[model samples]
Target: MTQRVPHVLVVGGGYVGLYTAYGLRRAARKGRVRVTVVDPRSAMTYQPFLSEAAAGSIEPRHVVVPLRTVLSGCDVITGRVTGLDHGRRTATITPTEGAAYDVGYDHVVLALGSVSRTLPIPGLAENAIGFHQVEEAIALGNQVIDRLDVAASQRDSTLRTAALTFVVVGAGYAGVEAFAELEDMARDATRHYPTIEPSDLRWVLVEASDRILPEVSDSLGRYALAQLERRALEVRLDTRLVSCVDGHVVLTDGTELDADTIVWTAGVRAHPDLVGTGLQLDTLGRVVCEPTLAVAGCRHAWAAGDNAAVPDLTGEDGALCSPSAQHAVRQAKVLARNILRAIDAEPLQSYRHRHVGSVASLGLHRGVAELYGVRVKGWPAWLLHRSYHMSRIPTFNRKLRVVLDWTMAMFFRREVSSLGSLQRPAEEFRRAASSTAPRAS
Candidate 1:
């Protein structure tokens, strides 16, 4: 009888899932196991660059890692795994255009990523866009620039004000960075508008928390606040958007700000699908794993990243390594190694790491950083902010391109051409076809 190779099924191609598979491929290929990865997206996104992608500092396409190309030797399936019957050792995968099938696996890696955390705010779901994906960030940049043009040409003051006003909900890394970067880009864009001054622009950053960047040291948060405020941004602390109706933003302070652009980056919660997955998940739908990254009490299953609540072994004080990409990527590496060890019948290891610090970009050439208990600000912090993340921007192809974009941006102007067509590719064609339609009236 011929020997059979073990099948390893990985769900979700995000950082944790992709890296987990990538790390195991070299070792798992003793001609013993085959790796199969499934994800809805064709690529993995480096989420930290989302803010800069929105700011036109880096090309959007470069921020993504094509799963197929990167994992050519591995089986890549583009489908949604709707159900998992771990006991039956089978996963029900619904392909994009085919009937569902049951794929049996010897081992499974769950890396389902997080989704945008939302609240029950009026018109938020329909009116506001999220910054979780590259498409959203790039579309937002186009919208911000296009709105600047619309505001400049419109004669009506009411319409102009609404067009120029912008509201960003959340003061975390995503919200703060997006707000700062977009505001900076818009300020520069306003230079081309003959009628609009930078003062006409209204940028409101609303955080329900008492402080912005609460994860960072208090001093760094203060530095960020000072920097944003110096640019005349409305920093609404301990405040939130109660409702946004037709772009009329009502804040918790009983204040209403009119704006056309409303960005939602409040926070991220685990994907809600894990509720009935038969896996041990936390209250937030995140799979609960042991210190060794194995699904608690479940054999042959493992998890990491936003979808998994692995114990933080750093002996931290009231912390579980908040669901940040920094932790997820590191966790993925360790989880991968442990998985290989598990296959080889070796001892598993515990996952432990301290969150060193946080850094954030405040507009152009300005930032704040807290590393090793030391705080930094101004251009140096900004440089560190760029350096650290640029080094972590997935593949070398993306890293080189991002650095080039930044370097070129230093001497030349940012490319503001909006491919809004990407959002609605056939918009013009539809308009033309409709205009040519026979008039029924």
Candidate 2:
């Protein structure tokens, strides 16, 4: 009888998952282990470029990596792992279709990332959108352009004002970059409408925090607030959206602004399902792992990235690394090497990386960056934002495509067509059906 190969199941295909799988694949080729990866999405998305993608600075396809193309050597399954039978060393997975199946594994790595954290704000779900996925970014772009159309055509001031007003809630990197980029695009896009000018548009940013881009230096954060305010954007720090009904956004400052579009990019939390796993978790609900990145007491399982509470050895005691891509990417490499060490019976290594500062894009040739204790603003910071992220965007193909998009954007205007139809695919059919319904005879 022939002996069977030992199986290792990896859940998720995000940044942490992709890098970890890459290491495992190399190890499997040299040994008798079979690696399997499961994720609902067919690709891994480099989320940092999402703001650029939304503003038409980079092509959407360039930021995503198809897992099937890169991990051809591994058994790839496009499914969601619903349950883990740790005692039996098996996991239950549910694909887009078909019944769930239990797959046995000798080892498991849970790299499932964080989701957009939300609150019980009134009318948010119905009126606001998120900035997490490619679809959301694309849809938001389309929505922004479509609002200009309504503003240009409507004669009533009430309707016109509502159409031109847009609100963004959050001051983090995602929200600030996205708000600045979209504001620039929307203002420039109005030129094509002829009837609407940049002055007629209203952009409001509501951040409950004391300052925007808290990860950056205090001076740069203040600089960002000034830059945005100069562009006529309402930067309401220490304020929040209390309620938004239909097209009106009510703020905590007792001000009501009528806006047709709202975007929510406040922050993210660890996936709530992690709670029931019985895995050790910290106060933040992130998996509690040792410095080696292995889950406490779960001998055969390990975790890292946004879903795990990784220690900040560079900081003093009782401090943890902020949940961001900077830490997640480094953790992935360390986690992968540690897992290999465990397999080969070598001493496991600990994760140790220092903070490298942060950067934020504030639309067309404008930005803020703080690197290695040096503060930058304006065009120099913008260049750094592009240069640093360009190198970090995994895969040469994606990097090349993004570079080409930027190169083209330099000489030509950003594309301004709003494919609003993408949001409601059946709108045309519904209109036709209603029109041909015998006139309510």
Candidate 3:
């Protein structure tokens, strides 16, 4: 009788999906198990570097790892997992350009990850853009430069002021870094526009909370606030965006401003698709998982990362792991090993690790970091932030490329050109075709 090899279906190609499958490569090569990864995009984005990518400190392409290239040992499906029937060990996958199909699996890894968590502020849906993906980062960079160009050409002072103003909601890592870095980029870009001065630009960061960089120490947050204020950037705390209708921003504190760009990076919720998986989920809609990273009450099912509520053994009682890359990457390794152990009917180890600390870049040569209760700031923190992420971004190829980007950036001025037309590459062709079309008789 031939033995049946277990099929592991990993949903979502983010940190957990990529790392878990990469961890199982040895077993996969030996034919001990078969692995398949599914995601909307074929590449896994290193999100921590997105701010730099947006600021042109690193090339946008360098921040994402091509899933097919990295996961050559596994099957890569360019699609979305619409639903899951874990009882039958099957998942329904909807491809980018075809009918939905069912994929049978012996085990499943729910790494669906999270999406931008937005509020129902008036006109927000129409005017705001999220900063969670590389595409958004690219669009934002282009938009900033394009706005600068518009401001420089406009004769009306009010219109130019509106074009020069940029607003970023939420002061978390994503928002603060994006706010700082893009401001730096635009400030440096003013040199190219002889008509524009750095003083003409207005960068505003609004956070409902009382402080920014909540992930770091309060002292560090204060320092970041001081640094940003010193740069003449507006940091509004304990303030909410009441409305942003047609580039007109109204705040809860009765502040009104005209801003052409409004960035949303408040927070993220677990993948909404989990509701259809029929798995046990917490009130927050995250899959409930044991410390071993196995889905609770579900056989042959596993989960980790932002999608799963895994217990934090190192924290106080009833504390769940935080949905950060630090936890997600570590959880992936433990999840993979536990899956293999389950296949072998061996003891499973629990996922437990005290978080080392946090690090965030304010902009070039400015940052804040806390490691093992030791706080660091300024240039040393900036270097630490770079070195740490450089070590974490997967693959030596990507690492080398990123290093080279930084090395070159040290000697050359950052590119400030806008390629907004890339967003509508077919517009020109369509216009030309319409112009040459035969007139109706």
Winning candidate number (lDDT): 3
lDDT per residue (tens digit) for residues 246-278 in model 1: 888999898987889999999998887676579
Name the 10 consecutive residues with the lowest summed lDDT in model 2: 23-32
What TM-score would candidate 1 get against the native?
A: 0.96
Best by TM-score: 3
Error of 3 at 105 (Å): 0.7
In the range 335-437, model 2's lDDT, one tens digit per residue, is 8788767767899898888989898899989999999999999999999999999999877888899999999998999999888897789999999999888
Global lDDT of each model? 0.87, 0.87, 0.96
lDDT for each residue of candidate 3 in 1-441, tens digit (9 for 90 to 100): 999989999999999999999999889999999999999999999999999999999999999999999987799999999989888888999999999999999999999999999888998999999999999999999999999999989999999999999999999999999999999999999999999999999999999999999999999999999999999999999999999999899998889999999999999999999999999999999999999999999889999999999999999999999999999999999999999999999999999999999999999999999999999999999999999999999999999999999999989989999999999999999999999999999
After the best TM-score superposition of candidate 2, give how far the Cα of residue 110 lies from its true spot, in angstroms.
1.6
Error of 2 at 404 (Å): 0.8
Per-residue error (Å), model 1, residue 388: 0.7
Taking all chains together, each candidate's TM-score versus the true structure is 0.96, 0.96, 0.99
lDDT of 2 at 221: 93
lDDT (0-100) at residue 54 of candidate 1? 89
Compared with the true structure, model 2 gives a TM-score of 0.96
